[model samples]
Target: MKSILLCFGLLFISFLSPDISAVRADYRSASENQEEAEKLYTELASVSDTDEVLLLGYKGATATLMAKYAKGVSAKTAYFKEGKGLIEQAISTAPDNIELRYIRLSVQENAPKIVRYHKEIDEDKQFILDHYPNLKDGETKKYIKGFVSQSASFSEAEKQLF
Candidate 1:
């Protein structure tokens, strides 16, 4: 009985051991993708022609992935903001782009923390809600409540924007 229990315990430990390796592999892959994204963004920045759509798409996708890999709120916020700016530029360049809009919505949804303005994020929340009203009722209600709760905390200038 003692040998059997020891064998079972060893088997369980073996089963669990690969998860750490997998996590390490994922981190490595994310790092590589981030580097690739930086290179793509540099290339895109140099292009003056309208045919840089593919490069812009690559930049957006990589920015999204970098945001996904961000382990903390500040890192995630930076990546999301960068992605949002790129998406906005892309939209302006192609106003009728449904794909760009979808990617923007995705970034907003997965952001690690809401964009802070004057220690409040209501305007950002409202912008998201305005663009993606089809989000679930519970989500909408939560943002509404957050916006209302935080309204008093905003500065005079911030209040005018909302």
Candidate 2:
């Protein structure tokens, strides 16, 4: 119990860095790897009270990834529901955050058809593309472009524009 408490304490402390680049990389990595998902979930699950939109977005994305790996239907639904709620809250809090929109687009693009999370795929894709050139952050623009280039949601011509 002591060790568990200490580990939990340490994990919460790790979130204080608010490193956007780390979270961005983790978002991409955790989306494709179960081990990365577990690590990200562990790191963010204890820090929900944070007002940081990027942190919250990554937390939500990690939750959805964990939902895919969860053992049962109920568990999967619970994870998805919680994660979706966090994501929606974060977007509602920061509608202009391109990173948050990209997070949503990724989730929606890959979400099960039955879950109906794809409503904003086009909107987000267009928003990212239209704003790509004007975005001040080169790394973020590159990340968004990279994802868009590979996204099935975008047309062949649209993908090439990036």
Candidate 3:
């Protein structure tokens, strides 16, 4: 009977939500590592449209980051456009989500000038600074602070706010 119970417990655990750790991991690593980016992208791809909105945002980030691994400008453009669609969709779904704003800000900050995707950099930065104090997740707050501290997008004075 004990062994049967144990088997049932194991089966129950297996049915729980998947380990979507990539969402919690640093997106910066995905920017530089193709394998990491692909894994993150794949992981986030499993997130349903009805799930947490930020998961979609992370998917967008991973897709955009994947462009770095593409072989040519045209292919890179396709990836960027696809990622941008997902990112924008998430933002539209939850306009006030700070994490989604951060995702967009990071993408805008890093995208090449020719892509003309920098329009939202200042807006997203200010939004983050203003809403950051209200963010509830300690882990996410830490990630945002760390990213801002290192990104050229945020000035030394601005970094202090994070």
Candidate 4:
């Protein structure tokens, strides 16, 4: 019975893995396919199996993209505010997460001055740079490398490490 239960659990976990991939896929396509990205984020945001903090961050990112494409000032403001709030919640929940810090830094770097969200750019940039070598995930390291290569926040000296 225990073996049966374990097998079932493993199967269930395997099924859930695709959603994680879907999130990553949608995130990567966000710039080119904002509509699909928004739908994926909205769907994933409600999934109980998804990490709350990650979902929140994804929601924040999707909302930011949505705001960029939104036609009206009111809609843009609402999306930006919602996205910012979700990101802040995620950051507060996982203050030590370098990935979360990176998300915040990216958001802050791009946010308009009117939003007043750029204050954390330097802090998060430093945290990511200081801790880059310690990140064990290959995908994360690749992402950080790609981000730093294009980011204005990282000095040439800092980016050379990647």
Cα distance off (Å), candidate 2, residue 127: 1.3
Model 4 lDDT tens row, 63-142? 77778778899998998987888888888888888877877887788788887888888889989988889999898788
What lDDT does each candidate get? 0.48, 0.85, 0.83, 0.77
lDDT ranking, high to low: 2, 3, 4, 1
State the TM-score for model 4. 0.81
lDDT of 1 by residue, 1-162 (tens): 999999999898566332322332332244357665455444344433254442354355456566666789788667766655666677678754333443344444444454531221343444543544444556334433444344443355544443
Candidate 4: segments with Cα more than 4 A from true spot: 1-10, 13-22, 47-52
TM-score of 1: 0.37
Q: RMSD in angstroms, all models?
A: 15.6, 6.1, 3.9, 2.7
**After aligning candidate 1 to the native by TM-score, how far in Å is the CA of 132 from where it should be?**
16
Residue-by-residue lDDT tens digits, candidate 2, 59-145: 888899999889999999989988888889999898888988999999988899877787888888888878777899889889898
Error of 4 at 49 (Å): 10
- Which candidate wins on TM-score? 2
Question: Which pairs of residues collide in model 3?
Answer: none
Q: Global CA lDDT of candidate 4, please?
A: 0.77
Candidate achieving higher lDDT, 1 or 3? 3
- TM-score, every prediction: 0.37, 0.86, 0.84, 0.81
